[model samples]
Target chain A: MVSEADSDEALMELVKSRDQDAYARLLDRHMGSIYAYIYRMCQHHNDADDLTQETFLRLWSRAATWKSGQVQLTTWLHRIAHNVCVDTFRRRGPDDYAEIDPDTVAVTDDVPDDDRRRAVHNAIANLPERQRTALVLCQLHGWSNKDAAEVLSVSVDALESLVARARRTLKRELSAYQREICT
Target chain B: MTADEFADLLDCYGTDSVAWPSSLRNEAVRYAQVSDEGRRLLAKSIAFDAMLADSTHVPVAFRLRARILERIATNESPAWWSWITQSMWRPALLAILPLVLGFVIGDMTSELDGDSTDASMFLAFTDLENFVELNESTATDD
Candidate 1:
């Protein structure tokens, strides 16, 4: 049995050699998270799909030049995904980000009760883009402040500020419920 | 404690500050223990954290998984085939087509020229004259 790390390196080697199995495995391992990330960023499924394909096509084309470095492959992929999302936002006029479907936006199932999780998910949807990405990376995805900063290409202090501002914003946004719930 | 003071505590609450002034920790604790408002705020913050902790997840759609994999497979199959074909045949083609077309056209013109013996050349000139006459007469008839 191959360890995941070993498998990842092997798959990357295969990917560099244009192996379909490797590409499929890589996609299988990451598609859901990648899709969710892109979906959150773009707020549209079709657009996410398009961006996902474009991301992979880029990876496929550039596979030959991929260097083994300090950054993990996941982080590399996230950077590419981030750039793709940014390009999409640039191409689509600022006002053209489609409104997220309530059902899709609130599809989280992390909480014991799905309904409550959905509520929190909806609240997350209201966060500004930087805050949303920071929150998703640090709070939801369990990334360390340093790791999240690396993924965002921000300073650790900057990421800390993003998370801090995000938490305060969330607190204020949910202040109405503070009285009833905390009472 | 004033909200400003309490807010500062909240910001530093998660940090591992070895240098966190003992005075600040005591003040925050005293506030949490005695002030109803502070207790309420702490509980609210805890709930907020829990909501975040318990909320986000990547929902895996099996159909979408299959579809993406299928797309990758289809895309790669064509590329793989092209790669294989290019590897096996491209050099051979590069070496062969120009020579082959050159040979074929050369052979064809040579055969035509060979077939044009003196007698046949004369026949060709007569045929051209006949074709011109026939076209002129047809135009006149029209």
Candidate 2:
């Protein structure tokens, strides 16, 4: 019975020893974030759910592989989630991704906020995979640029570039909505 | 910071001033405070950021925790012996077993044959000694 106050590293230590309670704790701590991250990436609840489970399963099985001093657990988990998404993308092929056209988004002021948000969601889901990932990590998830870069396996500069490009696209796509909301 | 520089910072680091690089944060805030265009861009960024944040309401993964816990419960790590028994090397060792046994058996048989060969050589040497002794005795008698 690991205490609730145990650090992620401490929980991971117990998980490495096949402690199910520690595994459960880590799951509760990370599963939502990982699931959301995957959901944002893949945009399919079923796939995101499966991928999140897969990510945690890897955490449970590969607990010993984690180097506590070298990398934070959240970064490591996100990295795993990133890889899982990549694998899914590879298997599903490029055509499976339903990229929503920016022009098709209802940018009119008369559109309801929910519809505008849906447009925003489609716009994000339609961004190039790397750009979307960078934006999701840095902007949506509130991860530091450096940490997000680590998860994306790119330099901080490259990650920043991805994020910048994503924001530019989003701003362009959502400019009308931005005006409407800001007014 | 110039308008383009300020917008770039917002684009890269986001609307949150705190999330901006420390060196740029104060300058960006100052620029937003002083410049009309900067303020407009900042406001737009803030609004866009709010939209982006609110765009996707991630629903709580229904029963995901229970499903994951169930999986963890079912998929216990294999024991140490299972690591060996489940490995490719198991088949490889099985394939080499006959050769290893043959080598050992052949070595034992060779050792037995070597002893017999040594005995035969000793018998042949003894026969030669006996023949020499008989010949010498016959010669002595002659």
- On DockQ, the candidate that comes out on top is 2
| Model 1 agreement with the true structure over A1-183: per-residue lDDT tens digits | 868655766788788777877887887777766777776665556777777777777666566556666677777777788888877776866576444345533323332355554455556666667777777776656567777788789997787778778778766654443333444
Model 2, residue B2: displacement in angstroms? Answer: 1.7
> How well is each residue in B57-108 modelled by candidate 2, as lDDT tens digits?
7877999899989998886756564345544577898999999999999998
Q: Model 1, residue A159: what's the lDDT?
A: 79
In candidate 1, the residue pairs with backbone N, CA or C atoms under 3 Å apart (3 or more residues apart, or in different chains) clash, namely none
* CA deviation > 4 Å runs, candidate 1: A1-5, A43-50, A97-126, A178-180, B1-42, B53-58, B77-142
All candidates' TM-scores?
0.60, 0.81
Return the top candidate by TM-score: 2
Q: What is the DockQ of each candidate?
A: 0.15, 0.50
lDDT of each: 0.66, 0.86
Weakest 10 consecutive residues of candidate 2 chain B by summed lDDT = B79-88
lDDT tens digits, residue span A1-183, model 2: 546469898888788777889888788878889999998888788988999999998887677679888999999999999998888888988788667765657557576877787778778877888999999998889999999999988999999999999999988888788888888
**Candidate 2's TM-score:** 0.81
